[model samples]
Target: MLAVIRYTVPESQSQDFAKQGQTILDTFAGQPGFLRGRLARSVDEPNLWALVTEWEGAGFYRRALSAARLVMYPLMILMVNEPSAYEDVHAQDGT
Candidate 1:
């Protein structure tokens, strides 16, 4: 299994941004390579969140995310909290 961890502080108008961001994330469920996902947000920071994602084997997260980021950056620049990223890793399969 592979995990992708992305964290970021969204801009001031986080509502709309987070909505679309969730749409983008939800799209992964329809993706042929997608496995599962875990979405989390900071209790102290409303705009801060970490999307822990799982994939089947390997994938091209960068390129795919680059496209999503393009849409996300412009509308939600003010909420920039932390770093947004995807990480590669090994995990034990529960199923």
Candidate 2:
């Protein structure tokens, strides 16, 4: 499963937002079933940021969110909208 959280930060808070995003990635990195995660900024919109993460499944992702050590929840609340989760519908083999 993939989780994507979008944030629209002001120019003055970009640095702080980036730091908090990295902290989220680090926190989830050690959790069970965590696949990978990345932080990205939109090319056309400087203040638009995205925190993308891949997990073994939706359940894994949900559990990670509830973990005690996951302190990124507060930062996540700053997202412009609710986070999104997606399921892979295509095969890597391209059948």
Candidate 3:
């Protein structure tokens, strides 16, 4: 199944969060079951953003979320692990 994880951070830690998030995405982009990240634009300010990251499958999504919780967002997250699930198939491969 396809998965989407969303979250928000407090306004104050936006910069730090964004920087670390970019690093994490870079680090995990090519991992098995990792798909791609869809970054959201801040509706209010530069500091605010909505992230909609889609993974290749839900198992990968769960494992990644667990690690991200432990390794990332030790302080800045206002919410976490907000994931939605559905059937997903790669467009190019139709698999």
Candidate 4:
């Protein structure tokens, strides 16, 4: 499962936002089912940032989030929209 959170940061806050994003990613990296995660900035929209993470499954992702609520709740306030979770429906080889 993939979890994605997007944020619209002001130029003045971009550095601070990136640092916060790195903390979130690092926290997730230490969890049981975290597969991979990244922080990205949109080329055309510099203030647009995203946190993308892959988990073993949706259940693991949900559980991890619940367990980390104390740390995540504050971070959630920075998001421009609700975070989303996606299930992969197909693969490059058509699996």
Best by lDDT: 4
Better of 2 and 4 by lDDT: 4
In model 4, the worst 10-residue window by lDDT is 68-77
Error of 3 at 93 (Å): 13
Cα lDDT of model 1 by residue, 7-81, tens digit? 465456556656765776776665566767766677887666656666654454544555466544654544445
Model 3: lDDT to the true structure: 0.61
- Of 3 and 4, the candidate ahead on lDDT is 4
Worst 10 residues of 2 by lDDT: 68-77
Quick one: RMSD of model 4? Answer: 2.6
| Candidate 3 TM-score over all chains jointly | 0.60
lDDT of 2: 0.84
How many clashes (backbone N, Cα, C below 3 Å) per candidate? 7, 0, 0, 0
lDDT values for all models: 0.57, 0.84, 0.61, 0.84
Clashing pairs in 2: none
Off by over 4 Å in 2: 68-70, 91-95
Clashes by residue pair, model 4 = none
- Encode model 2's per-residue lDDT on 1-95: one tens digit a residue: 89887888888988988888888888889789999999999999998999899999999898887772456766665687774789999747555
